[model samples]
Target: MDDPVRAFLEANHGAIMTTLKKDGSPHVARVVIGLVEGKLWSSGTRKRVRTAHVRRDPRATLCVLSEDNPWAWLGLETTVTILEGPEAVDQNLALYRALAGEPEGLDEYRRAMTAEERLVYEFTIHKAYGMH
Candidate 1:
């Protein structure tokens, strides 16, 4: 990644993620995504349709526009792996902190995650496009 691209990704920008539905259609969702340790990942639950689609097909795409300039953006075509174990919780929280700063009400979120399910989808970038 170039300097400008890396800076843009570091900012708090909204990301759009696309996954293939059961019928082979694209299912797009607005998500919080972060580039961590040279890879991209998104945190959420196992109950979402996005998770289901990813489970069925690992191929996905993520796009994020520059928070500084909307015209500038990053696009990535990736293969996703759903980490579904105890480590998912801490890993997802680490990604979340990197993207959204430290959570104020972490206890509530932890309870909810425990009640529901917290999963992290790690993305391996196969192809990417962005400006330097």
Candidate 2:
């Protein structure tokens, strides 16, 4: 992603992500996104249907919108890679910090994430279009 696009995404955390279902229908959900390691990242759990969908189909799209202006948005065609286990926990923490800053009780947070079976959806931008 370019600097302007990255900055726009940073300023706008809320987006609607599209993933494909088993029948090839679109499943859209609101997600909080952030740039992590030069890629867009969102946290999910193993139990969620979205997780299953993404795992099954790596292709996805994210329409990131600006909270302040309805006219401003960015649409990203991306491919997702699921991260789990210890590496996922570390990446998830990095994502959390990137989006929301540092959290209190880091250890507790990690424990909770592990208990919840948290995973990270790492998005590689394939194409993008929108008004920055």
Candidate 3:
């Protein structure tokens, strides 16, 4: 991610991410976008359709609308890497705070976070487009 895309992502922009289902259909969802170590990242539960889709196929796409101009947007053709373990929960926290801001329910959030199986997906951009 770079420039306007990065800036848009850093702001309160929502992302529409898509993954391929086993039947070769697209499953789309609004997701939290984050930058970890300067790379774009997203997350979801392992039991979810999107995560399962990613486990089967790494290909994905993320689209962010420019906050400055509603008509302008950026889309990325991306591949994902799944990271799991205790650190994955921590990664989820970082990604969550990136979009949702710091929550007042930190302890509750941590407890809830610890209960789920998480996949921290790092996006590798293969192509990008800025739609005017």
CA lDDT of every candidate: 0.80, 0.91, 0.80
The residue-by-residue lDDT of candidate 3 on 99-125, one tens digit each, is 677877888887777787776889899
Decide which is better by TM-score, 1 or 3: 1
TM-score of each: 0.86, 0.95, 0.85
Clashes of 1: 0
Off by over 4 Å in 3: none
Model 1 lDDT, full chain set: 0.80
Q: Write the per-residue lDDT of candidate 2 for residues 34-130, one digit (tens) a residue.
A: 8886778999999988998988999999999998999999999999999898888888899999988898999999898899999998899999999
lDDT of 1 by residue, 94-127 (tens): 8878877787789876666667788888888777
Best by TM-score: 2
At residue 5, candidate 2 shows an lDDT of 91
**By TM-score, is 1 or 2 better?**
2
The regions of model 1 sitting more than 4 angstroms off are: 1-4, 130-132
Can you tell me which runs of candidate 2 are displaced by over 4 Å?
none
RMSD of each: 2.0, 1.0, 2.0
Q: Specify the highest-lDDT model's number.
A: 2
Which is better, 2 or 3, measured by lDDT?
2
Model 1: weakest 10-residue lDDT segment is 4-13
